[model samples]
Target: MVTKSDTNSVQVEIVPSRFLMPETAQRLLCEIYKNGGIRRIMIHGPNMPREVPYGPGKGIPIEANRNLLVEIGDQAIELRVKVGRIRLEMESEDYLGGLKAACERALPFSFQFRQGKFFHDRMTTSDYAKYGKVEDERILGLIDPKAKKDKLAILSEDMVTFKEDEER
Candidate 1:
């Protein structure tokens, strides 16, 4: 029974995380390493999914936890950021890569939902209405972290259990 108005009062923030350039897949990092190093960089982290055009999307949404929402997608998940840093090898792959890797190693992020001052995720405040409220169950069966490694799956489960558990 959550209403759009309920969300109007909420704000969400995407906690920023680092990306290990090589961690994604070896293929993408070859050029970066061969060139020695990259100069200057910009990075972006993933955010709560706002409403998109009414076309079918790949997966459902998941709120970070019960009550307050910190939205994240599983299928067709967006990398929270648009830009990022380049790793230079000082000692070992895991070193430069690991520094970023360990920090980046959070793999998927964790969320905390609060009642007041919804996190904005640096989103355009004016377009806030387009972003609808979401629930945690939306993420259950969404991602197969092992198979895709990169993509997460929806947390699919029985609707009755989901709703019932959501309240607790």
Candidate 2:
């Protein structure tokens, strides 16, 4: 029963107050380097600060990442966040397939899951993170949540991580 307008439903996190304008993300880029190598990068100018109090449906573009889309609407800007990153952690490309199923289980959705499929042994790490499962902060849980939070490393970076593979 989802409609086009419903598809526009998005999560909003207002900064609560102030906005942080890093002079440049170059410092963050430099910290990632394991090797002492200096490289060149083409960085665009800083974004103009949107002094408007941030509330729901308010955001200015910062940098591009996976699943990011910028579209100009007749009245307001239409920013589309594709479901790409959401599926990446589950090793699944089927966005609506798995997530919708999770939503059905965790929240209010009219659907039923089939046997042997609702729980994936292959993705046990995210099995609990999927549906009807909440992580207890009391327990030191989750091996690597940060890994899933980030997109693939951009080769455009000035440096790279040199790991020693077993074969080496």
Candidate with best lDDT: 1
The per-residue C-alpha lDDT of model 1 at residue 61 equals 49
lDDT of 2 by residue, 1-168 (tens): 843422222211111111212311222222212222222111122223323237664664444422222221111211222111111112222332543433333322232322112111233455346422433321112223233322112222232322121000
lDDT of each: 0.28, 0.24
| RMSD from true fold, candidate 2 | 21.3
Off by over 4 Å in 2: 1-20, 34-168
Best by TM-score: 1
Which run of 10 residues does model 2 get worst, by summed lDDT? Answer: 11-20
Task: Look at candidate 2 and tell me the lDDT of residue 116.
Answer: 19
Question: Alpha-carbon error at 46 in model 1, in Å?
Answer: 9.8
Candidate 2 backbone collisions, by pair:
none
TM-score of each: 0.18, 0.14
Per-model tally of clashing residue pairs? 29, 0
